[model samples]
Target: MTFPSGGRVPEPYGQSSGANLADILERVLDKGLVIAGDIRINLLDIELLTIKLRLIVASVDKAKEMGIDWWETDPALSSRAHRDELARENAELRAHLAELERGRGQEDPSLERGRVSEEPS
Candidate 1:
């Protein structure tokens, strides 16, 4: 541990650096990390295909801080989104039914009398 300068030498690749896997992961999640890459395939000097890939790794809080909360509004991922979607659909259906009823009433004067036309047994 002694050096020529009479000071302790820093350990090489040792725990003293405090760079363990857990520590690295915690830092990554706290600060967030983005990996971006592009792959291109060319034939006869012409670009045929290109693929762009982006990946981000972070904690939920960090992701929200970065304004990346698509999961919250995605119906497949969020119950609240699914409920909202259902409510919207229900409202649309109700509106359509009311419109149809109004159209039918205009065509049949008996419908405006509020009389239920009983069907034959």
Candidate 2:
């Protein structure tokens, strides 16, 4: 396909039509594949932000062999840890809310009266 910029882009599925799909899959799964790219945002010749993205495609066993299994231990991905963290956070927020309510409840009426007395009658 020809782009507006006159650059020729190959078809998505046609690229591997001549090659053996099984051979490509075996090679990729065995050695793994790393696709990396950088995205930049520029405003009026000034670079505002830059983002780097990296992706790895491999079999589950291969990925684990590479020591890249963070999802296994991530609290959000683990049911027990997720529930524990949520419960702890909920208890803390409840405690903080109770403390604030207690402080408001203990407010001195004399302080309000003093402020009222200082105002013009």
Candidate 3:
């Protein structure tokens, strides 16, 4: 083939074009990327199964900037969340115990005295 300037063909799409895999990954992480899709299976025109997938790729700081800090409050991923969960459970148990004590006190007036018998002998 005759070409103007030196007779050289352009590289194919798969060939290196200066942008390597690392450079592409760096750009994706810096700007953040989201991939979302849904899959549905139908049987006889009736929906049988559905799967929705969502993925986000970004640095921790970028994720935080987007208000995606679920791991911070997830009990499985955070010790602070575990402590908060325990405190909430402890408070609930204490409240339940107090309610039971109040109910028991109102159920029996003679119990306040030394009499332990529930019925006359």
Candidate 4:
């Protein structure tokens, strides 16, 4: 097919004689039932289908992916998971600080100076 910009676009399914455009496309995409893509697929005994479409619409940041441990693990789908995690972590840290405050008789001026944890050696 030709675009208005004079670009030749490769049609996925050809314009057919007997079948309509949708019908031809559906036959190739749905009924023809061929699996070919970047992602992996594992079918057990050929009874059930397991289609893995690796659609990287945009570039993803890996560090964020590693930090959260979601999208790969954690089956629970939550839109506010990252915010929830931050809230939970903040709560835990507050609790710890409270404990520390309780442990020491005097208030720690150093602790209040905005200390962030460094990775353990």
* TM-score against native, each model: 0.71, 0.47, 0.71, 0.29
TM-score of 4: 0.29
How many clashes does each candidate structure show, in the order listed?
0, 0, 0, 0
Tell me the deviation in Å of residue 93 in model 1.
1.1
Q: Which tens-of-lDDT digit does each residue in 1-121 have in candidate 3?
A: 4478778787778668557977998888889999999999999999999999999999888899999999999989999999999999999999999999989878756665646565467
1-121 per-residue lDDT for model 4 (tens digits) = 6889999977566544446866666555443333446433547745355555643222124324435345633335555776677788899999999999788746566764434244344
| Model 3, C-alpha of 39: deviation from truth (Å) | 0.8
Worst 10 residues of 4 by lDDT: 54-63
lDDT of 4 at 4: 94
Instruction: Tell me which residue pairs clash in candidate 1.
Output: none
For model 2, the superposed segments whose C-alpha errors exceed 4 Å read 1-19, 75-121
lDDT accuracy of residue 81 in candidate 2: 74
Give candidate 4's error at residue 105 in angstroms: 2.2
Better of 1 and 2 by TM-score: 1
Candidate 3 weakest ten by summed lDDT: 110-119
Q: Model 1 lDDT vs. the true structure?
A: 0.90
Model 3 spans with C-alpha error above 4 angstroms: 1-19, 110-121
Residue 33 deviation, candidate 2, in Å? 0.5
